[model samples]
Target: MKCLIKECDSYDKNQQWDIVCDNLWKLPLSQSVLMIGVLLGNLFFGSFSDRYGRKALFNFAPIICFTSSFLTSFAPNIYVFTILTAITAACIVGMSQASFIIGRIEFIGNKYRVLCVNLQEIVYSLGTVIPGIGSMADIQRTDQ
Candidate 1:
């Protein structure tokens, strides 16, 4: 139970379901759904791209990702937020791995392909790390 936890916030203490979801434990379920979406997106898009052409899927994937992300911000409840996040995750995984390689490699000259790939890796790494860095900064600021 949340009461057993050492750091239950007011959200947990007051039993506030009118303002937010009562179940904080649903985070893992939401994350699992998001990963499932990612897996499905990769398999579906990988095959779909092969069948329909990578270019179309390459151009379209970001739109799907963006739309889901945009909708997620306005979600009225945890269920909608979770589903939208899952969709966003799916599109992101599919587009990042599948479309990125196909589109990036084909557009650039042979001489610049390696450089492009390297840049992509650098950008991806930064994207992954920035969140952790931001979280650390936020924690430090709050501690002050």
Candidate 2:
């Protein structure tokens, strides 16, 4: 979200409407599609993980996310970047949450599941907070 917002702000300031439109126009559509896809993917993966296993999908998801994010960062054009971002959204972010939940359930016992999940949420929030603090420090430095 921060990255997207920063990109949009930069484009706005530079008056790069063509690039911005090309990159952002399909984002809403992609987000909606990914939301639906994530729902279906979660249901499918949740069932599959229960029957088969979670390790395979859990390990593979991070690789897909890293690769897609790296590719998107280096994309030559707005169209390619947008497509890569959409693919990342669908394949990486969409599947990763479900995979993580399944993996956690498989590894941990039932009694601790809720606590473990909540802890995970707390950790994620802390991760975001760290970056926010860093950004705030940067702002303070610039104001000096």
Candidate 3:
């Protein structure tokens, strides 16, 4: 993203909009926005799940995440991209934690809860790392 931004002088493809210029502060701002969205999702959905049930939120969140993520891909400018990304991030957090994790723990035996949670986290970590590894491999291939 940093490379692309520099290559384009922060302009969108076809030069329709300016993303940022003179500095790259918006990158951090976008990340902070995503974190804020995650925090809000954790707070709201955690309680909402307790009240409404995990299935409702779990079913709903993915739809929102997919829609927002799809919209984000077509964002006309940085602000729009940031907003949609935040929404996507929040939905993902709500779906992954408020619904799935809680529901998984609740259905399992108490003695196994900790182990199950740890395993879940390990799987999630691997899911994250796999993409990074794929990107690294792509970079290496390009370098070669």
| Candidate closest to the true structure, highest lDDT | 3
TM-score result, candidate 2: 0.45
Question: Per TM-score, what order, best first?
Answer: 3, 1, 2
**What TM-score does model 3 achieve against the real structure?**
0.67
TM-score of 1: 0.58
Q: What order do candidates take by lDDT, descending?
A: 3, 1, 2
lDDT of 3 by residue, 31-135 (tens): 899899999888887887888888888787888999999998899777888889999988888877865666677788999998998998899999999998887
- The pairs that clash in candidate 3 are none
Worst 10 residues of 2 by lDDT: 12-21
lDDT of 2 by residue, 15-130 (tens): 34243443456556656655665665566656655666666656665677679789977776555665666556655544666657656766899899989989988999999899
Model 1 lDDT, residue 93, Cα: 84
lDDT of every predicted structure (CA atoms)? 0.77, 0.63, 0.79
TM-scores, all candidates, are 0.58, 0.45, 0.67
